[model samples]
Each structure stands twice: as structure tokens, then as C-alpha cells.
Target: MNGPNDWFQQNQDRYRREQYERQQAYLRQPQRPTGPPVRQRRAGRRGPSPLVVFVFSAVGLLVGEAVNWFKDVGPVFSSVCTVVAGLIPLLLDYWKSVAEEPAPGRGRAGAPSYDRGGTAAGRVLGVLVFIVVAGAAAYGISWGVGYVTGNETVRAERLVSPVAGRADSMTITVEGVGVTDHYTKVRISAVSRAPTAVDVGVGHDCQLVDDGGQTLQPSTVANDQTLLVPANGVTVRAVITFTGRPAPTATTLTLDFSWFLAHDFGFGAHSLQVHEIKLKADPA
Candidate 1:
């Protein structure tokens, strides 16, 4: 029997009270995180923790250095270390193998959307840092190998005169001496007063004599064919190579036997002499 206006007023007050109670209950509940994992805003994919990425990269670099230190000791052990270093990047995605349940009813609808803004930027930065550190570590390790082994090569080049030696009546002249990484090459010309051109012998019998008389021969050596003495003596050119550098002062050359014997015996073991000429020291 109440008027319609009175009933409407009572109903409005009841609705307001109910809404206030519901809000109060919601506030009482504990706060919870609903956002994606840190550093990853890939809407559907989980990203690696930044801290973990940094630690993994640092460990990788250290492992790489260790590998270089022990590489010469055991190839097998070094191989293992290299493998470990190369696996660092794989750690970032270690958890990726576990399949993620897609949003219900969202599967097959389309590719999940990603927050490409800040999330993508952070991931890019992380990868860049990893690469830079890795490259620096590799370069440092290579340098360390050279330092630890003490096998650096020597390089030098200079014009030199005939040091010394002779093959009976034959004459040999040194035109240039070049010393490069791990080897030395000597250019020379040879001629014999004989009426016909004679062979220019080379091989085991040929050696380099320093001022100290250290007779060292190349583990291997070769000549451009052979030097011949034409009637006019065309001053044929020849080359000699050795595995290492000679003393600052190399003073003699020795090639043995008649030039003709060279034709009969390939790289024969014989001795001859080409005495010193305008030999001079490398400029200080």
C-alpha cells in the first residue's frame, strides 16, 4: 500500500549499501602480481631473467679463456671447454622447452600478441651485451695463447751482399736477403768461367753460416730450376729458403760438387763455397 516514490527510494538505498560492502571485501584480499615475468613482455612466452643472462655470459667468457690456456695440453679437454663456452646462449632458452598452455579458446585463432615496445628493446640489449663480452673474451684468449707459447715469428727484410763460399771455380753472388715470419729467403746469381753453362747445385749440402760458425740448413729448400753460366753469363737468378731467421750476421754460403752433378742427382748432398762479398748488417 506504500506510494511508488517511497518504494523506489528504498530500493536505491539498498543497492548503494550492497555496492559499498562488495568494494570493502575486495580491498581486504591480498595484492597479487598479474603482469608477465620481468624483462619479458612476450604476451605468451616467458623470458629469461636479466641477472641470469649476465651471469651466464660472464661464466662463458671465463670458460673460453680457460680453454685457451689448456688447449695445447690436451685436445680432448680443450674441445670440451669450447663446447661449454658455446652453450652459454642456450641457457637463456633452457626453460623454453616446457610447453606453455595457451590462453583458453585463443589457440589456433592467431599468433599471440607481444608487447614489442619496452620488452623487445630489453631483450635486444641483453643479446648485444652478450655478444660484445664474448668477442672480447675470444680475442683476449687468442692473444694469451701466443704469449704463453713463446712461438712468435720473426719478420725482417734487407738487401745483402754475397756472404761467402765457392764451388771450385764457380762464382755465386747474393742479391737480396729477406727474413719473414717463420722463414728467410736469399736471392742469388751464379756463374762458372767454364765454356758451357754449369748446374747451380742446392739442397742439404747448402747451409747458412753465421759469424759464430753455426751451420744451419733449411729443413727444406728449393731453387727456380738451375742457374747456368751462358757464354755471356746472363747472371741467372736463384732463391734459397730456410725455416728460421739467421743470426744478425750470417757470413757464409756452402754448396758442394760440380754444377753438372746437380743434374744427375736431384737435390744432391754436396758442398761448394760462395765467399762473402758486400755483406752488411741489418740497419740498427
Candidate 2:
């Protein structure tokens, strides 16, 4: 029943009240964002870079080689140091990569879960690389040492023939002495008339006599033909007989000794020889 002016005034008042109530409500309530909170990319822990690791490894190798060049130390030691130094940083990088990677089942929906960290396969490969590098370095060092040392030598002597007889039995003798960086086995031989021929019997109507002057058996003759000598100074002897009717013309006997050095250090072998001669004639 109000006039136009009155109705207008009432409408204005209602509108103002509603606006005031809305303002009051807004002031009383906590401020809230209209949308979801923005997620920020997290910064990862800073670590040494792969490039840095590689550079350090190279430096280590160079340092190791330098040490070997300047010092008389064995190649093995220097190479080991190089390998260990080079591998440490690599191993650390591998471990760090593994630590920074997200574990399984941690990715968002529909997103592929990546094990950014090293896998078991990668770790195994790294270890194998380290071992290979180490082994190669060690071998290089050993070779260097051997090259520098050169081949070693030892001296030895042996008496080739100590006994001589014609239709007579006599004992031959051998002797020797020497030094070596390794163990060696020695053999000595005695021959009649010719240093190259082993003779156990005579046929010219002459016969070797034992103390009883009896002809010696071929086995007995050959049995006394060889001797084994040791590395150090040693004296060895063998007895043999000659048989011939013409009193077995005077005969010459010869002895020869030889040896070979044996060792495990990759050093080459060494050897020596010695000889002796004697004459035998019919026993007056």
C-alpha cells in the first residue's frame, strides 16, 4: 500500500542490508583459495656430477702413472692406488643416484614409476668395471717391473769326467758350485774316448778288471755313467770298466754337466755347463 517513492526506498534498504550481511559474513569467515594449492617442484640435494667423477678418475690414473715413473716402487702398488682412487668416486655416484631415486609405487596415477636410482644391474656393472680396471692396472705394473729388472743370471760349474781306465776299473768324479735367483736341476754325463758317445764295454781282446780284474757287466758299465748334481758346490763320482785284449789302447774319457733355472716370478731361465777329460791305459 506504499507509494512509488516508498516502495523504492524499501527496495534500496533491503538491498543495502543484504550487501552488509554478505560483507560481514566474508569478514567473519577465514580466507580460502578458490582452487587447489599449487605444488612446487622440490629441489634435490646437490651432489657431485658424473662429469666431475670422470675427471677425478682420470686424474687419479695419471697420478698413479706419475708415481710409478718417478719412484722405484713396483708397478703393482702404484696401479692399485690408481684403481682404488678412480673407483671410489664412481661408486659414490652410483650410490647417490640410487638414494635420490623415488622408490617403487611412489608415482602419480597413470605416470610410469621410474627407479631413477641405479638398478641392481647397473650396480653389478659398476663393480665389474672397477675390478677390470684394478686388474689391468696391476698387470701393467708387474710387466713394468719385469721389464726394468731384466733377466737374471746364475753361475755353475761341473766336472765332466773324473775316472779313466784301460782294461781297468776306475771312478770318475764331477764337481761344481754356483749361485742363482731360482732353483735349478743339474745332470752330468761321462763318456769314453769321445765326449758324445757312451761306451760300457771293450772288444779289442782287452777286458775291464774288477778288483778281481774280471770283465764288468754292461749294466755295471752303464750304471756308472751318469750323476745328478745340486745347485750348490757338489762332488759326485761314478765307476766304470774297460775290456780289450790289446790292453785296450789308451782311451780318452769326457764329462759334461748342464742345468736349467726354474722360477715362478716370470723371470727367464739361466743355465751353465762344465767339462773334464781323462786318459786310461793298460795297467802295467
For each candidate in turn, the TM-score is 0.37, 0.28
Q: Which ten residues in a row have the lowest lDDT in candidate 2?
A: 177-186
lDDT value, residue 113 of candidate 2: 37
- Compared with the true structure, what per-residue lDDT tens digits does model 2 show for residues 206-248? 2222222333221232233433322223333433222222113
Off by over 4 Å in 2: 1-55, 69-71, 103-112, 145-284
Full-model lDDT, candidate 2 = 0.41
Question: What's the residue-level lDDT of 196 in candidate 1?
Answer: 52
Model 1, TM vs. native: 0.37
Output the number of the lDDT-best candidate. Answer: 1
Model 2's TM-score against the true structure: 0.28
Q: After superposition, how far is residue 66 of candidate 1 from its true place, in Å?
A: 36
Tens-place lDDT digits, model 1, residues 1-284: 99999999999999999999999999999756554333334553455555665466556555654654434232233333443554464443643523343445664433443333345477667656655555555555544543344222224455554454455445677776666444556767776555554665455546665556655554442333344545334566666665556566654444332333333333433346555433346543
